[model samples]
Target: MTWLLVIAGAAVGAPLRYLTDRFVQARHDTAFPWGTLTANVLGSLLLGVLTGAATLGDHRLHLLIGTGLCGALTTYSTFSYETLQLVGVGARLYALINLALTLTSGLGAFSVGHAVAQAMST
Candidate 1:
């Protein structure tokens, strides 16, 4: 039952990830993977919220949303690929930009989500 729920969530998350990738790629072109970065940041936020809530309530909820959905929605492979591409193209500035943006945004999003969840519980 739990596995089924996770699988379903993954199915949804994967497609959503694909759509986000396509949309961002279309808008920004294939030069950089802005789409993947956005998805990962958003996913990190959602996972933070889910995990915080689960700590206060139910674990299964976190498993389904964070571990399954967000996990599938954010592709580390894409991030790695983009970073390597940046280095390969000798775009040191762009690679650094990507690294800083991804880390900062992801951390910010996670903090916001955790704060929100904590507030909601109180």
Candidate 2:
């Protein structure tokens, strides 16, 4: 049952990740990897919310959304590859910017999500 929940979530998350990446990247003309950043930041926020709401005692929710969905939705490998690609192509500034923005934005989004979830639970 637990595994099934995780599988179901990943089934949705994987395609969603791909579609979202394509959608966001299509609108941008830069090598900044906006699509990857968006997906990661969104995943972090959702994980934070799930963690914050742990008191709700829904283990299935954790396994499904947190483990499966977030695991598939966020792509650290792609982020690293893109960053390295930027550096290899002499776009070091863009690489740095991507790193900085991804870190800060992901953290900020997670914090906000956690706070929101905590408040809602209370």
Across residues 4-105, which tens digit of lDDT does each residue of candidate 2 receive? 989988998888889889999999998789999999999999998988889985789899999899989988999999999999999999999999999999
List where candidate 2 sits over 4 angstroms from the true fold. none
- Model 2: number of clashes? 0
- Runs of candidate 1 with Cα error greater than 4 angstroms are none
What is the lDDT, from 0 to 100, of the residue 94 in candidate 2?
A: 96
Prediction 2 global C-alpha lDDT: 0.91
lDDT of 1 by residue, 1-122 (tens): 88876887798889989898788778985567788898888898998788667657676776678768998998888888898899899987888888888889988998899889988988
Error of 2 at 20 (Å): 1.0
CA lDDT, every model vs. true structure: 0.83, 0.91
Tell me the deviation in Å of residue 26 in model 1: 1.5
TM-score of each: 0.90, 0.95
Q: Best candidate per TM-score, number?
A: 2
